[model samples]
Target: MLDIQSLRRDLAGVAERLASRGFMLDKAEFSRLEIERKLLQTHTQTLQAQRNSSSKQIGAAKARGEDVSAIMAEIAGLGDALTAAETALQALQTELDALLMGIPNLPHESVAVGLSEDDNREISRVGLPRVFDFPVRDHVDLGEKFGLDFETASKIAGARFSLLRGDLARLHRALAQFMLDTHIVNHAYTEVYVPYLVNAESMRGTGQLPKFEDDLFHVPRKDMEKLYLIPTAEVPLTNIVREQIVPREQLPLKFVAHTPCFRSEAGAYGRDTRGMIRQHQFDKVELVQLVEPKDSYATLEALTAHAEAILQALQLPYRKMALCTRDLGFSAAKTYDLEVWLPAQNTYREISSCSNFEAFQTRRMLARFRGENGKPELLHSVNGSGLAVGRTLVAILENHQQADGSVVIPEVLRPYMGGLSALRPATD
Candidate 1:
């Protein structure tokens, strides 16, 4: 959510930045509704004040042992009007909130003002792609040889699902465990276990609900219609401080959670149809941070580097892209996407996405910190895929495959996998 004051103060400027992301703010309509809301609010308060004053007069008259019936009648007359005004005022406020929630965050000044991923600037490419001796097979082809079955997974659970057997399945688990440990131990992030399911309000806090429902798996509940199934741990982890006021000393709060990320992939039906790149459910070790607004940008760089360290340790080749404004998500003021090289696909694909949401999410979550000055202020939020487990596995399979049909495990994963160097085809 955006700061309503900023929207009211510089609506046009905010709209222009959002335009790059294909979100257009209805400035005139918002302004008109806001004006109506203000007028109704003021009128309601005035009527309330009048009612209070009349009540005091009635008390005074009764104390004097004089007739208070006429004053009582006047107060009764004000009741109907007061009720109507109060109802209208509440309705206007609700409308304003809905409008504000739909608006995307304004891009930071440092964010590139471009329209799409293709226009994103490449900040750096770390590690070099390993040279291959033979024709490289994609993860899908390689998995088929090693009992990574998609056909059975699809028949059982529908498309974009995979079932790994023996070493491959265990390797995936090892990857997530390693990633989570690295972020928590070496990077100063506190490990957390968050809810796999969250309410709609939780989704909205992370900028996923009101507009992007199609991309989520919503579980129905009785009474309130609250949704469930978290798309990422970012939802639950960052919302921990929702409606909280932490001390300034706790300004930079870092959290990492290894959880199963669920996505409906509604609009992504035809894309990445093969392999685990696009799935309804996948393992992800996510990183989240809550910090003072002043430290957000610097924190973004540090956070991105923290994610990069995983790739470095694993010796995976990856590149960082400074996402263009148009490429930024609804909740992010600025974003960096870490794309890892996939030898089979012969291209770099997103393995991680780190973003600085500034105070966009903090406002919605009501996450604030008590400043040194002792005033409550919205804290900035940042989250990233420490790395996507399935994709990292895909990159590993394709990049490290030998001509002999064995997959060489990355050196860093050796200890986690009980020092096994390679995965060979298992005999029935």
Candidate 2:
């Protein structure tokens, strides 16, 4: 949430910045609402003052042993008017809050102004796509011999789902474990275990609700608040500091979690339906950090490197991209997407997205840290997928596949695979 004062000070300036990202500020409506709010607030205050004065007059009349009924009646009428005015003011404030909540975070100045992903600026590329001596196959074709079964998965859970058997399943698990271990051991992140189902407030704190509700999977209750299946570990990890005020000593709090993510994929019907590229459920190792506001931009670069460490360790060829204004996530002021090379697809696809929210989320969450003045200040939030386990697995299958359809395990993942050098077809 932006500081309301900023909007009041320069509505046009804020609107122009927002326009770069394709959001149109309703200036006229906001102005009308603001005018109404001021009038209602003044009227309410006036009535309150009148009632107080009338009560004092009634008290004086009683003390003098004289008639006080007129003053008493005036106080009663003022109380009724105050109640109505206060309610109107409250309703108008709620409307304004809703409008602000729906607005996306303002992009950082460094973010390029563009309309789509194609306009995103490339930062750097690492490693090189391996040369295949034989005809290459996509993950779907190459994974079948190793027990990648989608038909059974469909019978069990419908389309956009997958089931892996034998070593193929282990590879997926190994990827997640490898990512978790890497971030915990080398990246200075505290590991956490969190619930997969969260309340609506948690979703809203992370900028997922009240706007992108359709993209989430939720569970309705009989008489209680509905819970949502987290779309990423980022949701749980980042919300740890919700409504908290940490000491200055703990300037940076880093957290990591490996969890299964659920998404509805609403409005995305026929895209990437051929395989596990896009699924209803997938595993991920997420990284989150809370830091002092002044250090957030620097932390963003370091955090991006932390995620890049995983891809580099696995020897995956990937490129870092700075998302343009229009392509930025709803909560992120700035974002960097790591796209891993997929040999089968003959292209690079997003495997991780590192972002710095710059107090955008903390404002909504009331997440704060104590400053030198002993006052609370909003903390900046940063989070990214150390790596999406499913996409990493897909990249490995397509990048490391041998002519015989076997996959050579990346050296870093060997220990998790019980020292196995490669995955072979199941003999069954």
Candidate 3:
């Protein structure tokens, strides 16, 4: 949520910034609401003061052995009006909160001012797309020879589901394991295991609810609050400090989690439906960091590099992109998307997104740390897919495919795969 003070102080300036991201600020509505709020609050305060003064007069009259009936009656009459005013003030604040919660975070000054993905700036490219003498196959075709079984997965679940058997399944698991180990050991992130299902408050803390509710898989229970299947481990890992104020020494808390993510893909219908590129359930190793506000932008670059390190270790060619203002995620003030090369598609596809949400998420979560002045201040949040396991698996299969329909395992992942070098077709 935006700082209400910022909005109150410069509604026009905030509105203009929001307009750059294509959000039309309802200036008239906000102004009208602000007026109503001020009036109700003032009226309530006046009534309260009158009640206090009249009660004091009533007390003095009683002490003097005089009838206090009139003074008492005056105080009594103010009671109903005060109650109504207070109620109105509460309702106005609620409305204001709802409006604030729905607004996207303002873009950082460094973010490029553009309207779409096409305008995103490419930061750098690493490695080179492999040259294949034989015909290139997408992950689906390459995995089919080994064990990518979609028909069976669909029967068990439905569309946007996948089942890997034999070596292919091992490769998928190995990718996730490799990512978790890399972040924990080399990147110095503490490994965490979090719940796959979370409450609505957790969702809202990460800026996933109230706006993207349709994109979530909600589980309704009898006489219990509805729970949501996590769309990414980012939601759980980042919310670990929600409503908390950490000590100053614990300024930068880096955490990583390998978890299965669920998404309804509400707005992604008919896109990337052919393979594991888009799935209802996918495994991902997520990275999250909580840091002092001033250091967040620097941490974002380092976080992006940590994710890039995974791709480098896997020997995959990829490019880093600075997302344009319009392409930025709802909670992120700035974002960098790492797109790995796909040999078959002849193009790069996003496998990870590193973002600096600044204090946008912390404000909503009330995640803070003690400052030098002995006051609690909001912490900035940074997170990314160290690598989306499923997509990374796809990239490896397509990028490392041999002429004989075999997929060579990346060297680093070999340890997790028990020194297995390649995935070959299984004989019946």
Candidate 4:
């Protein structure tokens, strides 16, 4: 949530910044609520003061042997009025909070000003797309030979599901394991195992609830709060510090986790429906960091490099993109998307997104660290998909595919694959 004080200071400026991200702030409603809140609060305070004054007079009159019935009655009326005003004030405050919660984070000054993905700036491109000797096949076509079964998956579940068997299934697992080990060893992130299902507060802390609830899958409980399936490991990893005040010594906390993420894909109907590019269930090795404000931007770059290391190690061609203001995620002040080259698609597809949320998420979580002045201060959060495992598998299959229908495994993953260097179909 945005600092209400900032809005109070300059609602128009805040509104303009949000407009760049396509959110129209209802300033009139906010102003009305603010005015009403102030009036009610002042009236409540006045009532309390009057009640106290009357009570004092009643006591003094009793001591003087004078009737205090009128003063007592006046105080009783003031007390009732105060109760009503306080209740109304609380309700208005709740309304203001809901409005603030729905607002997206303001883009950082460094973020590019644009209106869509087209306006995103390319930071760098790594490796060249391989020259193919024959027709390039998408992951769906190549995967069918090695046991990628969408038909069986749909029969058992529904659409947008996939079941991998044999070498393809093993390769999928290897990708996630490799990414996890790489982050833990190379990037020095503490490996974590978190619940795939989290509470609503956990969702809200990570900016996933209330607004994007439609994009989530939830498990209903009888007479209990429903739990939400995390859309990314980023939720649990980042929320580890929720409602916490870390010791100053632990200024920065880095975490990595490999987990199966579930999303409803509510708004992405008919998009990437052919293969593993978009799935209701996908595996991702997520990286999250909580750091002091001064180090957040620097941490973002380092975190992005940590994700890039996996692609570079696998010899996959990819590019880094700086998302425009309009393309930034709800809670991210700035973001970098790493799009891996897909030969079959003849384009780069997002395989990872590294973001610096600044204090946007921490503020919502009330995740804080002690400052130099020994005061609790909000920590800045950074997170990224070290690599989406399914997409990484897709990239490897397409980029390293051979004319003979065999896929060459990267050297880094050979050990994880029991020294095997390539995946070939059983028919081969």
Of the candidates shown, which would achieve the greatest TM-score relative to the real structure?
1
Alpha-carbon shift of residue 168 in model 4 (angstroms): 1.5
lDDT of 3 by residue, 1-428 (tens): 88888989999999999888878889899989999999988889999898888888888999999999877776766888888888999999999889989999999998999988899999999998988899999899988888899999999999999999888888888988899998999999999999999999999999998899999999999999989999999999989999999998977999999999999999899799899999999999999999999999999999999999999999999999999989988998999999999999999999999999999999999999999999999999999999999999999999998998888998999998899999887766
lDDT of each: 0.89, 0.92, 0.93, 0.93
Expressed as tens digits, the lDDT of each residue in 272-348 for candidate 1 is: 88788999989899999999988999999999999999988888899999998888888989899999999987889
> What TM-score would each prediction reach against the true structure?
0.97, 0.95, 0.96, 0.95
Q: Is candidate 2 or candidate 4 better by lDDT?
A: 4
Off by over 4 Å in 3: 49-71
Q: After superposition on all CA atoms, what RMSD does each candidate show versus the true structure?
A: 1.5, 2.0, 2.0, 2.4
**Candidate 2 local Cα displacement, residue 65, angstroms:** 10
Candidate 1: worst 10 consecutive residues by lDDT?
Answer: 219-228
Looking at model 2, the pairs that clash are none
Better of 1 and 4 by TM-score: 1
Clashes of each: 0, 0, 0, 0
